[model samples]
Target: MRLPFTHSKQEPANTRTARKLCWDSRDEYFRCLDRIGVLNPNDPTQKSKINANCANEDAKFDENCATSWISYFKEKRVVDFKRARALEEVNRNVENNQQAKGSQE
Candidate 1:
């Protein structure tokens, strides 16, 4: 079966990486759209004024934002995974302790 967004063999199956890339792209697009403000979705007058200047600025901002978001998510996922592992370890230790105590009694 074909996996979702699988580009090539060089790319391994990494949910965190994929999530980061998606988030980054979305952020970039949104930032560009925001700067363009052609369809402000809030103000009407500024829409027309959003010419090349807005478009260009928006595009750059969007790209940066998207990349930043991906990096942020990657870091966040790592931290979350670490925390989960630690919790699992703690739970296992507790369970073992309980079992040991039970055996003594």
Candidate 2:
């Protein structure tokens, strides 16, 4: 996983073990965010919430991941939460439509 052009042998992505640690930390942090009902960790208003609710998990994520990857994960968490909400909405609509049809029959 070592990049040829850079001297990043010490980089997290250069080794599978480091990547695993980053991913695990990211998941832990995101799970904490979920528990706190926070979809956007980078929001200014949410900063205090995150600090209060998930400071330890956030610290682990920051420790394990590279700076570039940390930002990427933060942005991706919002997108993932939105996607899950959309899926739930669509499923609910389908179920309501089916129930309505059943009642009409």
Q: Candidate 1 on 31-52: residue-level lDDT in tens?
A: 5655554333224565555544
- Candidate 2 on 41-95: residue-level lDDT in tens? 8899889999998999998898888888999989987897789999999999999
After superposing all C-alphas onto the true structure, candidate 2 shows an RMSD in angstroms of 3.4
Candidate 2 has what TM-score? 0.78
Error of 2 at 72 (Å): 1.2
What lDDT score goes with residue 38 in model 2? 85
Clashes of 1: 2
Clashing pairs counted in every model = 2, 0
Q: Can you list the residue pairs that collide in candidate 1?
A: 24-66, 28-62
Clashes of 2: 0
Prediction RMSDs, each to the true structure: 14.6, 3.4
